[model samples]
Target: MASNLPAPEGVEIQEQPTAGAWGEWNPTEDSVRPVRGKHRVAKQRGGLARSSTVLGVGVIAAVGASGIATAQDRPQVTISLPSLPDLMTGGDSGHGGAGDNGRQTDGGSDAEAGTAVRTGVIPRQSDHRADAGEVLRNRILQQAESQQGAAEAQARAEAERTAREAAAQEAKDKVEAARKAAEAAAAEAAAKAEQEAKEAREAAEAKAEQERLAQQSGSYSLPTSAYTLTSHYGDSGSMWSSGHHTGLDFAAPTGTPAKAVAAGKITSAGWSGAYGYRIVLELEDGTEVWYCHLSSMSVTSGSVAPGETIGRVGATGNVTGPHLHLEVRKGGSTIDPLAWLESKGLNV
Candidate 1:
């Protein structure tokens, strides 16, 4: 029989009969021990080839797993294969057996695998960290917006509080100002009333004083109407029986009314020797006043008040014209009537 198995490297092929073995085999360790200057075979070529094939298959499987991993990690990815004609154009015709074995290992016919390869497409992987970053950015922006809204609400609240406080303060200020204004007006009114009262009191006092003076000892008035001082008392002239004037002479028209100088009583009235229509008055101070040369006598023997009309003036009692001879006598001695009247607070 022809052997189909290849020989190991550094060893010759020979037909050898073995008593215990049933087929051709490699040299046993006991029979193939090498001495010096002889090389020992490391591994058979067929075994190396089988190991290489397994490593290639493992690498292809690892690449496919990496592609699957990429598809899982990325979006919008596609997986497709090349066409059979493209694969055949890139491979040697002598590799048909290998391709058939590869097709068998991949669980498909060569045509189907080639067709799948031609149609399959792969896409790039996406970064999952980028999507996570986008989510983080959106969260940050939302947080920022929330914080801004909260801050704005707080600001609005603060503004409202400030406005309320200001309004309250304004009301308080207005009340205070109104109070002060009321106080000022009240004070002004009080002062005006006080001044008016003071003026009224002073006017009343002055009126009372005038009335009192009219009733007191300081009261006096003119004794006659429309009279001129024609002769004074004790004038050195030949108009009297004693050869001198004895009283003051007031000359006037006839029928001029003569009044009492002060409050007195009429002691004597009527005509006398060398004195016509005469009247005499006795005062409270024991003083006497004589009125000679009267046109008429109105008072009888009675008390008289100051400023009362006693008689009228005329040419009587050795007078030159219509005149009055007024005499003041104390203890039957004559005195100047004008001086005596001035001493009694009379403005003659």
Candidate 2:
């Protein structure tokens, strides 16, 4: 028994009979089958083109994702630093980053950049502090030098003043010594002058006393009676061998009164050889007057007055005749009676 199968829509059905079998067989076609030769090769080429297109799309999508991630990270790349405005204006704003200036850039992390800026600014501040210290040291040294100079000058001035004072005191002492020497010289000169004046006065007084004594010794007066000179003093004749008169002979008559010629005391009233009754009278100045050749004596010794009768004239001894022999003497020397008597304003 063989039977015919019904065919489906848009398909042809075919069957094959089995040998020695009684049934017809219909084989199902495979949905995936190996194409033969050139048809398989053509199908492989189409599959390769589709795979290259898918790979190109995937590479493009990966590049687009990398660009988007880079965009998002742009705002996060921060650099913190000091800004120009902050430095110039001395602002208190604490915020610092690359956003402040678009032109400025940094190669380090945020903290590292900030530390570099701070280190860079420290050198300028330290330099200013060093300069101030140097100025202060110089001022201190200059002030010390000035003070030392002033002290030295003051010491020098004091030394000069002391030297000047010593010189002035020495000069004053010298002047005082000279003044005392001059005063002593003046006193010595005055004393010498006074001594000389006293000597001159003594000499004048001695000369006056000598003149007064000479005047007293030369004065006398003579007795008055009528007489004649017979033998004079110093006359030589044959009456004596020596040819000299020993006494003055006055020729007068006997009994002729003899008078005293000066005021005196009668020192002698007696007789003697070559003179009859001789009488000697001593005057007030110690001079002797003799009346000789007297015949008689009226006044005695120690009694006589001026112009008083002392004796009576006569030739008593060694006489030729009656006459008077008169003599005058001062001290011990015989002198001419006429001349001595005339000097006292009397005439024989």
Candidate 3:
């Protein structure tokens, strides 16, 4: 049997059996030939069919669980009907229906409902702080306006006070000035009264002195007989060199008797130069009397008598016609005869 077998060429043979404690001859290819489709179909039908049924059942169960979960996630709400009084009032009431149900019943769609829900979120506390800050700013501005008004009022009051004070001072000044003027007027009136009184006293004294002088001079008689004055002393005319007649001239008819003016001694009875026939008489108290332009002399020199005939009126040297020139002298100076005669109680 070994001689008739061929030589082993690409054949693989085990040298010894595995350590399973059993040694067995390898089976030939004819005994382990590849079976056709029937056996594989039988094997698959036994185990794979049962496993596919289990997997299908698990998938259906998962789909059912997902649908149940989706149903559970949908929004659910409960709504209680409002009370009759709340429904009639129409305004917001605590007993109103649930917010979601009210919105839906009031015709709010899903999108509007979502917007209203988002708007209902509570505002931050910081937003309230901002509002409060705005209110504080407005209050501060109002206070500033009030303060400004008060300041203006105070300024006006001050201005009025100043004006009043100025008016008061002006009135005071006017009163003071009036008082001073009144005092000045009174002083001027007093001074004027004093001056008038002084003038009156002086006038009275002068009158008294004049009366005493007249009383001391005794009475005298007329100087000429039936003679009229032709020229008075200090009379201006062309007959004299000095433009003034220094002696009184009396005009009478020729041979008119000239009497003594007073009780006096005959100082001279002669034909003087200018006075053709003249007589000079001296009284007791140094008074002198002159008789000029005489026609003739009745008494000689050194004769003394009262109311005695002294000379006769005549046209003599420098005489225009028959006239008597009578003159009176006191202490060798000529005096006004008319005034002297009047002082002696004679209206000559």
Candidate 4:
């Protein structure tokens, strides 16, 4: 015979009875067994509730493991069943499976069952979820910092490149300006040098001309040796046929020597129109000199050398006293003899 006996802790335990010890088993009697009290009903309900709660915890653990496996590169994880704590305890069975305290009839209260589930499973799952959340937050922050650093480095490099270009451009401009200034200075120097050279050449030419004039004054002599200058040419007078005096006068005693003024030919040695004797000498350049009012003529019509005696002074024709009248003619015109001699560099 098989007997369903309630154990000491309200758990049902089945036993095999020896043959013939109990009568033939009746299934209807077992099904229709009468409940003794409310404690027995409450004990049965509590046991079923506790089993269901344990099953629920296993399902939750499996879900947590699946979530963790999908979040990382790892092998698929196995769902392990949670170990359930024992709900029953040994007690005296003389009081029909109840403890000495009446409160123990329902095996254990709802509060104790809930405590076992939480202590074994809920705390471990909460800790795993918190760790996963922290790792994700840290990774996101590191990526943001790295990207910001790269952007700042690129901006600094670009700024340096722009500065270098500006500096190079400024240097080039300065070089160009300096080059132009140098060229301008050189051009000014060349112009100044050229002007100085021109001035020096003009001054040299003037000095040479002065030296040439000094050399020409040493070659001429006067016609008479000693005489007093009584009259000058171009003097206004009525003592002669013309209205003006046409010759220079040298007054001296009779028989004074008269010399040739330069090397020339004697064009005439005697003259009669002035009521006296006269002599005329022709120079090499066709300039003629007249020696009038002469007491005697020494040279005739021939070439005479300079400083040679030509005649003697006397109070002869065209003269009011013993004086020599000297006339100079060139190209049929009479000019100032003193002025003509000075032009030839003679200090007359």
TM-score of each: 0.38, 0.36, 0.42, 0.44
Query: Each candidate's lDDT (Cα)?
Result: 0.65, 0.57, 0.60, 0.62
Name the lDDT of candidate 4.
0.62
TM-score of 2: 0.36
Query: Pick by lDDT: which candidate is best?
Result: 1
The sequence of per-residue lDDT tens digits that candidate 2 reaches over residues 1-348 is: 344443334322222133366442221232112212110000112223212212323333443445432212222112233333323233312333333332322223323434534344321345545776888888888888888888888888888888889888989889988888988888888787777777777777766655543342233334647778888888888865467765577687888788787788998888777566788888887878788878898887775666778888887776788776777788777788777665555545
Clashing pairs in 2: none
**Cα deviation of 11, candidate 1, in Å:** 99
Ranking by lDDT: 1, 4, 3, 2
Off by over 4 Å in 1: 1-218
Sorted by TM-score (best first), the order is 4, 3, 1, 2
TM-score of candidate 4 to 2 decimals: 0.44
- Model 4 Cα displacement at 189 (Å)? 9.2
Candidate 1, residue 310: lDDT: 92
What digit string (tens of lDDT, one per residue) describes model 3 on residues 301-336? 775666688788888878678888777898778887
